[model samples]
Target: METASMSLLHALKEVLSEQQVTENQTVRELHGRDESYHKESLPDLVVFPETAQQVSEIVKLANKYEVPIVPFGLGSSLEGHVIPYEHGITIDFSLMNKILEVRESDFLVRVQPGVTRTQLNKELKKYGLFFSVDPGADATLGGMAATNASGTTSVKYGVMRDQVRDLEVVLADGSIIHTGNLAAKSSSGYHLNGLFVGSEGTLGCFTELTLNVYGIPEHVMAARASFPSLNDAVEAVVSILQAGVPIARVELVDEPSMKQVNLFSETSYKERPTLFLEFHGNEAGLKQDVEFTREIVEDHHCLDIEFETDNAARNRLWEARHNLAYAFIHGHPGKKMMVTDVCLPISELSGAISHAREAVDLLGLPGGIVGHVGDGNYHTLLMIDMSNQDEIEKAEKFNEQIVLYALERGGTCTGEHGVGVGKQKYQQKEHGQALHVMENIKLALDPDNLFNPNKILKTKDRG
Candidate 1:
């Protein structure tokens, strides 16, 4: 470590308990990389702070010494959002995991940055409420908000940004601020909560968050529908949304992914393009919606559709869909998983997914296409052999082709995954002059470029 780096390290040690500070190689390695295949850069030291004040103190010390600091949760980010590329200190929030408050009547929950969605849901079960934004990873709430994550449930309950009601943030100059209030609706100030939630730690570190929750639905139903082709599956979802089916969740799984799901999950689900559908409401209302959804799918030439009202059966259905990524990882022992996320308009989703399948085939890569088609967002999961540079290049080229296709048709390069180095290049093309405004915000909030350096905007003086 350099003199300044070592000095900052010593300062951090003095500020916190000795057990909270460590330069252990094993711990640093664990903090080095997230779930992404992006190259790892280990941190010089790791620190555990159990309170927002401690996080504030750490931020002050980092700014004082001109050292970079990155906030880490469970390291579940897929685009390298948690990786400490600048080799500074990592503030792992695992130790701070706690449910701060559950305002049951208000349908809101206040939690520390470390609480995971499943963990919160388990607690909310007692109150007959649930936190709804599940990104399929049991990811930390702070990590989810940083990436503005969404999943199958997002088609109904909405994404992380929509759930966040307030944020207790520690800024670059050690000043703590709240971006929003406890009210359900407000036009009082600038949408700071909106700006900070998806800023990917470039703005500041979120210590505590107040979020919206929902009461458990009176009736819940899930189904799986198999289609002959990918376009048919996507078109069915679009039609379902168009016909006002009020779907709680609608996910598309291509035939190739369905095969992987069967192989890994040990279930004989039809190895064809499939749609996972769900409805949440009172029993009578759900019955009407289910019938309407069935008619819509049959109109689009669905091969076979089955519905499950049993809770265990519904759980099994989603568990397989959520495990698709791990299925690929388990099947390919030595390879890495790169999932390309792109979202387009509902009118263009069918074409976009078809183009994605052709690109994967044209590149001769082993990949699967799946998505939350209810919201016009989809992903191409590419399994790459890391040792083979040629395969890696092909996978990257496949991503570029799909991204360009989405951009050309009024879609985003990434739907849920934030611009964590992987999607930074397209920020200019996507945002154009608006990119300059983001850079200005970065420079104004963190002029030293120390907060999660080289993420999102790739700001001034970051070279």
Candidate 2:
């Protein structure tokens, strides 16, 4: 086995620079896991491919050797999407990180998959534009697109799929193809861009992407609204959305999560259910929206509402929210974090969240609840000691209960966190006959199941 592994490594080095290919134990360990609680497994080898042609060649080698190929970005995914559990070759795209072209007038930027959300935004800022799909982890664009990630601003702008206009993909057979064109909308062929966005690397490796960008809004206002209860916070979001305030972002961080934030961030945030809110529009329009939003929150029995007046202050507000997971991890020493998110219709969100809170309390888990709740999606963060089987079982039960509850109410098992291994069992229940069509599509695109095998569409080996 060691000799065969060396043979594969030598073959990979032949295709690229020797420095770009490594089988070092440390590098393999880093590529094995993602930001989830799933068991991590190291790939036998790791390859850094700097071009679409390089990616194509690597995929061809994987197919020739029947070794699984898993595409990796920044390893920020929360649902174990990038883990090379089957242990083959992991393609790391960090060297391919570059901003290729910025078509400012066209509101499109073409970039390599290795470019990150924050990095792309930094570059786009010079052009008076910004990429709106922020999954909050500084995740790579390819990984974000793989998971179809959306974040706080999704309520107004849209998800990752909405931002991606076209994709340059290398398929299972090493054929490079562009899934879509630069045109705004096309009826010319199958909507491959959308189909591939959430496929979770089960289809092909994305090499380059043409994405839609938006001009920075004229006026931006951010606030934190503390509510008396979790239900109150969620209800206020539904009311705000229904009222059409053109809210750019509204997040729900429950009471416990607020405590975690205060502890980890060294801020005396109110130890109660809170909603982080942001509005983008004209100055006069934002003023009116802020006034109206204040009224709505007050109607929902908001305790206190405070607005961040400057860019630094606003960034601090969202930064604290984005770091909520890290806050929980910091608070729970030497414990793994289990996060589950569900999406319900706005009407069903309050009840769903209430149920989640109850389940967490009932299970006696130390955790927090924070979410991109403006779009009826929320995440529950639970800290579990890996050695404690009882705690793991209870956490699994908690996850199952919430997923079943949401599914019964026309909610999905996940909203932003893609269906990696953790959520595969729920796919059939969630999609029913539609799941079969997805299977057919997967088989059609990746016949040998060599591309990120056993991820979204589970194979019998893992199941």
Candidate 3:
């Protein structure tokens, strides 16, 4: 270890218990990389703090010693959001996993930052309540909040920012403050909740979160509709939204992705442009909605449609969709995955997706396009042999093409993935002068740039 890192480690050992601080090579290596294809950089030390007070103390020590601190959850972020690029202290929140409280009447739940979305939903299910945001992986609520993650259900319910009612954050200066209260809406000082939720750990660390929840609908229906072409599938989704169908979840999985799902999930779902959909409402209302959705899709060249009301069938259908990424990884041996996503306005989604397919064909890359089409957000899953520099560069160039297309058509570089190292380069192009304002905010809150340095905004030139 470096001399400075050793000094910081000694100071941290004094503040936290010996067991809480470690320079173990295995642990550091594990905390070094996330789910992205980014190169790994191990931290000098990994610390597990159980309380908000301990987090504050760690932040103070990091600030005092001029060391960077990166907060880590399950390391499932796709954009290298949790990688310790600066090689400082990595705060893993695994030991702090706990669901603190549940207010059934108010539809609110207080949880520690380490609590995973699946874990929270399992508990909420007992009370007939559930959390909305389901980001493929069973990501920690804190990590989800950090990225403002959303998925298929975001079409109807909302994203992570909408669900978060309050957060107990530990600032860079070792000060602990609550960003919001339990109320539904407020005309308070500043919208700190919005600012902190998607800051990507560049602003502060989330120790606790109070989030909104929803009751399970009285009746639910799941369906899969196959279309002849990608354009038809996306156009069908646009029409569904325009026609005012209350869709709980609407996901698009292309033919290539469907093949992977079939191979991995041991099911024979037709390998075609398919839309996995769900409706949440009373039985009578859902029937009408499903019938209406079927009619709209058929008009757009839909090949076939299948509906499932049984729990087993619905679970299996969604499971295949959720596990699509893993299926890709399983199919391609000895390759790293690079998943890039962008969001466009619903009106422009058809052209954006059509452009994406053309790019993939032109590049001659083995990739698949899938998305939560209800909200105009989509992802391209690309696998590459990391040893080949040419492949890496080509994949990056392809990603840039897709992002530039989104930005040109009034979209964002990332729909759900936060601006970690991957999307930092496009910030200026997408946000223009507003990028400067974000940098200023980072400077104001973390003047020393001690929190997750070199992420979202680059303070120094890269080689």
Candidate 4:
């Protein structure tokens, strides 16, 4: 190791145990990249801090040495959120995985940052409760909060921001602060929870989180509706929402994605534009809602609708939707996946998606569209050989076109996928003067740009 790297390692080892710190090439390489197709840049060292105090001490040491600190969770992020591009210290939170307390009465849970969604849900199952933010990946709760992630259930349950009741975050200078409280609502000072939830670690590192959970519905039903065209499926969703159908989850999978799912999951779903729908409530109420939804979809020329009430069948239906991204990755052996996420107003969603499909076809790329369309968010999954400059350029153009369409219609470049390095360029265009306010917040919280530098916002220098 170089002198500077050795010095930093020694300092980290002093704060954490030798077992908690590593300079192994394999470990560094794993920490250097995320699920995104973005290029990787390895960190100098990786540390597994097991407590908030340990995280705070490590941050203090990094500040003392004038080095960057990137907080890492499961590294399942799709926008380079966990990649330590600055080659400094990457704090891996895996060791801190623990569900500390379950406030069953209050419908809340306190957990360490490394607690994954699957792990937490398994525990919540025993309490007849569940965490609603299911971002497809079994991402850590801390990482989900960092990205303000939302998924299928968000249509009814709201996003991660809504689920987060409190966050125990370690600031850039090693100070610990709670952004919220257990109270359901409060006229509190400066809604820090809102500010930090989607800050994407550009603000601080989360150590512990207190989140609101929900009781599992008394009755749950899952259904699949196939439409003749993508436009018809999306329009059905819009009408369902307009009529107040109270959908628990509604996801759109284009024909191409449906084929990928059938191939990967070993199922014989009809290869067509499909809407995976879910309902939650009493059986009688859900039946009424389901009937209304069926009528609405039928009006939009839905070819066929199938309902699944059995646990096994419901799991299989959602699993197919959740595994769509991985299926695309599996289909393209030597290519990396680049997913474009943009959300528009409900009335404009059909047009936005239509434009996106046209752009993908024009670019002549192997891509498919899928989304949690109940909330006007969608993604075009593209597989590209990074070495092929022409393909990469075309993919970039396709993403730009989709983002531009959304922005022009008062939509966001990214709805759930937080602005890591990927969506930074659209910040100024989307937020306008508000981007300056965000920059000021970053400067005030992390003046030295030590936390996840070059993410979310651009800085002239690391210093």
Candidate 5:
């Protein structure tokens, strides 16, 4: 007997407008990939639902038909989270791009899933407010929340979870629920909002998000400090943080990364391991921070200090830092960028970075290290030919080794990036019995494992 889900294409054609559903091979193929280094999996169908009500109804149909539903946004995920490997429905949120409310007085903004960070920032500029969780991509706010993403600004502003005030979720059973309240602080029941924010769409579908916003800083300055050695730069960052310099954005890019940026971004920065830093505050406060930061960097045997005080120069400096990922991508066309992230305590950062550099050298991979050093979180972007089996094996071992290094030093397997499929194998080792507790909660919230199944938790095969 044919399952109800087997007839979903026909049912969807009957209920949804033509523009809302499509089984076109091109569309399905487009929806089936993310920015991961993994192989792609095309969904059997792609659906675009425009509202929370529509999402709930579609999920209800999916539940009744026992069809898997994968939520998709900008497809900017570095992990394989957005791929519908089970070949069911992929719900695209492009049509849901609506900014529902801009509560400037409350310093909060409510927006639908499809609104991208750049789009929302452009809109927020008029109000003298901005959202802070930037993952270098103009990714959708829902996607950012799903991954708990962070970028250069995360050192001071925190990640996606820190900004999320509430989430409007569509459960696996087609029930609609709100995960949190509008208040700034809450001692409420279960912290469902926190749970769902980093759930990577495995727990429920996020249709709308209320996020905290910040008033634009009055003054901003960017600086680049190059060290003779990577350890000197690492120690400088530790001292800056320990001394409470109030540095807004402190990023570390190693010598090879700097060289890549020079070639890709067309700017001649020193071809040595460097720290790109930013300070934000009142002019007086910023000046004080700059002086203090310079003293610390110099004390750590700093080689040079270049500060950009003009707004245009400051913007350009950050643009270079933000474009580092793009630089790698542009420099290595046809090769996939296999990026890995691990965060260590400040005390262990220098050692970990040294270990990472050694591994990269031994593996003979064309990769570079850059990170939000203030938080001791870093990423290594490897340019690899996916078809090369030996290269692929080296990448996997390198990732495992780095993760093991971090875990042994009381750090996490992943810092900002959630445990999408790529890091799921390490879940047990990282979380231990806490992993079971997470699985139990998953069972309670999504008993059938219908919502983003095989993501954060494993389950029996529906087949």
Candidate 6:
């Protein structure tokens, strides 16, 4: 019998058009990994499917061969979800990218999985609508759904899961299925939409998505507020959320992260713990919200507050925050960005973050803490020399300690970044009995475990 890789490659070439397949090392290397903590291992092949039919065929072939099929997007995932650990096929969705339909009346847009968030937003702007799941990078919609990603705007607009109204998925056995209808809020069948949204490609591959879009607010404003201490800045976010200011974005930048932003973005942001905020509404409502937020921030001992009412200034403010991860990468010439994501309850956020900061400081690690504070989610992006075993161990320990703290506080090991291979160890600890149910679901959907094998749910050892 032919090897899994050879057989799957042959089947893919036979079914797909000439443009849909490649075994080029350069291209395979590019799709082999994501922006992650894990090391790279190239996939045996790369298949670019342009339509749902094509995707279904590719998955069917892989399933038949009992080979792992890792779905590739923009390669922006912080976890190793896209990495083909079992080394079979990397399905690249870039060719399938297209805006299928835009329903202005219904506030929804149907798009192929490969379309990036920025790409979708650019087209939507003509209709006065925008996709709200901005993960800083222009990540593909399919990757966003796979990771159930949330970002700066998530506190108000909800995560990728919440934005998706429907999904066209290609299951492990190469059967195509629609997860949801256009109608919002359905008590319909088993909530398949929710299951696939964050499934991380373990059960099926998303070929297309009908996502919820938002209208451009009549008024929008951004502000940057500084505090003497990081905890004070964190406290202000808690206060703002509790007061219900309807903040669109509330991001916390530590002094170190602020320094990196200032240096990389060529902006003179004060090197202090700061909260960058955005408010959206009608003119009168936005003004009221800003005023209310100011009062709350001042009460928390805010050192200074600056608001950006103009488009250019507001864009600059958000650009600095969004470009933070890149800033770290740019600042450290040869270092990799190893970030930890742990989310806790609002009440415990400050404690969790404080402990994380102490962990970094105590270990003398070069890292910075920034957070989606309104939602009690934070990340510590550590710039480390990958060659140094000591530094790598420190990064791993920091992640372990922070995750344990969050788990103890009714929080998860990862807030937005899904449990790819990197976070699998924490799954049982976080979910316990729920994990058993997840395993059962995994078995039901892809008993062969060929879809994104060794990710999210690892069953190789059990088998």
| TM values, all candidates | 0.98, 0.98, 0.98, 0.99, 0.98, 0.97
lDDT of 5 by residue, 268-361 (tens): 8899999999888998898999999999999999999999988887887778888888899898888889889999998999999999999999
Candidate 5 Cα deviation (angstroms), residue 344: 1.5
State the C-alpha lDDT per candidate: 0.90, 0.92, 0.93, 0.93, 0.89, 0.89
Alpha carbon lDDT at 134, candidate 6? 80
lDDT of 4 by residue, 1-463 (tens): 8887788789888889989999899999999999998989999889999999999999999998888989999999989988887889999999999999999999999999999999999999999999999999999998999999999899999999999899999998899999999999999689999989998889999999999999999999999999999999999999999999999999999998999999999999999999999999998999999999999999999999999999999999999889899999999999999999999999999998888888888888899999889999999999999999999999998898889989999999999998999999999999999989988989999999999998999974875
lDDT of 6 by residue, 305-390 (tens): 99999999999999889899999999888999887989999999998888989898988877999999888999999988999999
Model 4 error, position 177 (Å): 0.8
Q: What shift in Å separates residue 377 of candidate 5 from its native position after superposition?
A: 0.5
Candidate 5, 211: how far from true, in Å? Answer: 0.5
Model 4 lDDT, residue 101, Cα: 99
Give lDDT tens digits, candidate 3, residues 1-463: 7787788888998889999999999999999999999989899899999999999999999888888899999999988888988888999999889999999999999999999999999999999999999988999999999999999899999999999999999998999999999999999799999999999998899999999999999999999999999999999999999999999999999999999999999999999999999999998999999999999999999999999999999999999999999999999999898998899999989898889888887776678999999999999999899998988999999999999999999999999988999999999999999999988998899888888999999975322
Q: Lowest lDDT 10-mer window, candidate 2?
A: 454-463
Error of 5 at 256 (Å): 0.5
lDDT of 1 at 36: 92
Candidate 4 backbone collisions, by pair: none
Of 1 and 5, the candidate ahead on lDDT is: 1
lDDT of 2 at 92: 96
lDDT of 2 by residue, 279-364 (tens): 99899999999999999999999999999869998998888999999999999999999999899888999999998998889888
- What stretches of model 5 exceed 4 Å from their correct place? 1-6
RMSD of each: 1.1, 1.4, 1.4, 0.9, 1.4, 1.5
Candidate 1, residues 169-250, lDDT tens digits: the string is: 9999989999998999998979999999999998999999999999899999999999898888888887888787778899
Q: Model 3 segments beyond 4 Å from truth?
A: 460-463
